[model samples]
Target: MAKALHPTQVIVRPLITEKAARLAEENKYAFQVHPDADKTQIKDAVEKVFGVKVVKVNVINLQRKARRTRTGHILHGQRWKKAIVTLAEGHKIELFEGV
Candidate 1:
């Protein structure tokens, strides 16, 4: 059987919470990405979109947790991956500027 080679898509949004924003300014940018996305794809996407040299890419896979609704219905959260990309020192991406 032959498998398809669909390229992983990169979502162009950063986690801009207080902590994430601080980290981004400190050379660590956090992004919510696809679970199937690998380190190389992440690093390349970040560099290409942000125009910064990615030093390293750290991926974290998060498990979906079950949540109960007010109507007593239970549902599972979405499973996804997060990437913490470290950029070269002195190089910064201004996506969070004035935010």
Candidate 2:
């Protein structure tokens, strides 16, 4: 994170799932972030892209999972990082509101 990265490049996409849906109630939102992006980058990206104040940032590295193909060959999934961003109270991302 030496040089600043664009918000779009820093944050890959929003992580929409049952677990994430539940966490949203507490002002915490999940996102699929670039592997090279750190917590600080994540916080900056979320704030710039979503126009919301970020309270905290938590990140996790998701390991690549192996999947068997039809011919029994192993296919490895891509390794990516996840960011759980907590926003300041009363601030919201419209993209997450059933969009």
Candidate 3:
């Protein structure tokens, strides 16, 4: 069986961006989560850490992109996972409130 991760380990950080802000208005929030974590783990982590009811969870795998340096070499960016969590209608996470 796979080892379970703690809530803190599952959630890397809150994604604070223009798009995230707009989603928050509709009771949805975005978080940068552990790439290995699944949708159910993300849902449980969000609920446990934020103390909110999770209505739905959506995940997106952001692939690495290749970029060239000024000198000459090409490098690839790191791959990460993003989770868009929709909370229950009356619930809200305070962290996104002021942003």
Candidate 4:
């Protein structure tokens, strides 16, 4: 059987890009997540780890980009999925508290 994953495992990392930062300020927690993870898993994980109620979850699959390497060779970046989790009103996560 597949070993159970902790709440932390559900969320690989909180994406802190310019766009993600703005969403975070608005109580939207965005993260790069496992491609196979579903909405229910994401909701449970976010709430369990952050101790906050999840209002909604939006997921997007981002394709890897093809770029040129230093040696004039073509390479592909990694493909990953992203999840935008909206927390209940008045709920907040402290991950960006000091940043």
TM-score of each model, in listed order: 0.83, 0.91, 0.94, 0.85
Leading candidate by lDDT:
3
Error of 3 at 46 (Å): 0.4
lDDT of candidate 2? 0.90
Residue pairs clashing in model 4 are none
Compared with the true structure, all predictions reach lDDT values of 0.78, 0.90, 0.95, 0.86
Tens digit of lDDT per residue, candidate 2, span 1-99? 255677789999999998998899889999999998888888988988888999999999999999999999999999999999999999988877873
Tens-digit lDDT string for candidate 3 (9-79): 99999999999999999999999999989999999999999999999999999999999999999999999
**Higher-scoring candidate on lDDT, 2 or 4:** 2
lDDT of 4 by residue, 18-69 (tens): 8877888888878998776788888999988889999999999999999998
TM-score order of candidates, best first?
3, 2, 4, 1
Candidate 3 deviant stretches above 4 angstroms: 1-3
Model 4 whole-model lDDT (C-alpha atoms): 0.86
Model 4 ranges with Cα > 4 A deviation:
1-6
Scored against the true structure, residue 28 in model 4 reaches a CA lDDT of: 89
Question: How does residue 70 of candidate 2 score in lDDT?
Answer: 95
